[model samples]
Target: MQATEPDYKCGVEVTLEVIGGKWKGVILWHLKRKTLRFSQLRRRLPGVTQKMLTQQLRELERDGMVHREVFPEVPPRVEYSLTKTGWEVVPILELMCQWGTARLQGRQEEKEMAQAS
Candidate 1:
């Protein structure tokens, strides 16, 4: 079912707006493994620029989907993990992943069959 204007006016919409960006899904996927440091996240997501990562992390933090912890040390350290609200998004993501995989497989089979004809 498609969401309406009233749906757009609530927390769900705001959460979607934050996570709907290109890199956000990947970021969330990686975080689902375990809490990660900034550099760790960067390594996992190779193509994302440092600036974009910083921006996305800030947005996630602002949206309450990510918890950022700062360490007092010689070099400043930061780590990120999913908040309770963020954890709630995992099942939705998993279902979407399943659908996407099935859709891709279907399209590939169709293409191959068309080529054989």
Candidate 2:
């Protein structure tokens, strides 16, 4: 049997549903540059617990935003990368990063001005 699609009210809602969580967007952002192993991702994201990261990755894979490649080896090697659909979200993530940088800069300038006054 095939899975049913989610009934989203709007595009934004659908966007948020897929990437709104604390770790999902960050995970996607990290995978934007290149494929990474689970350990590499864990190191980049300091605050995320192993269990949570695993859960988030599983969700992303299920959503078709991430591709998990497992290599046959003595132990096993798995790497994660963004899917084509995932690449489509990079521009939005970049815009969000720019907006956040601007906000931080504005706050820092405000702080300096207040200190000088």
Output the lDDT of residue 56, model 1: 93
Candidate topping TM-score = 2
74 Cα displacement, candidate 1 (Å) = 2.3
Poorly placed runs, candidate 1 (over 4 Å): 1-12
How well does model 1 score by local distance difference test? 0.87
Q: What is the number of backbone collisions in each predicted candidate, taken in the order shown?
A: 0, 0
How accurate locally, in lDDT, is each candidate? 0.87, 0.95
Evaluated at residue 60, the lDDT of candidate 2 is: 92
Give the per-residue lDDT of model 2 (tens digit) for 1-117. Answer: 998988888999999988888999999999998999999999999999999999999999988999999999968999999999999999999998899999999999999999999
- Candidate 2 structure, TM-score to reference: 0.92
Q: Which runs of model 2 end up more than 4 angstroms from their true locations? A: 1-6
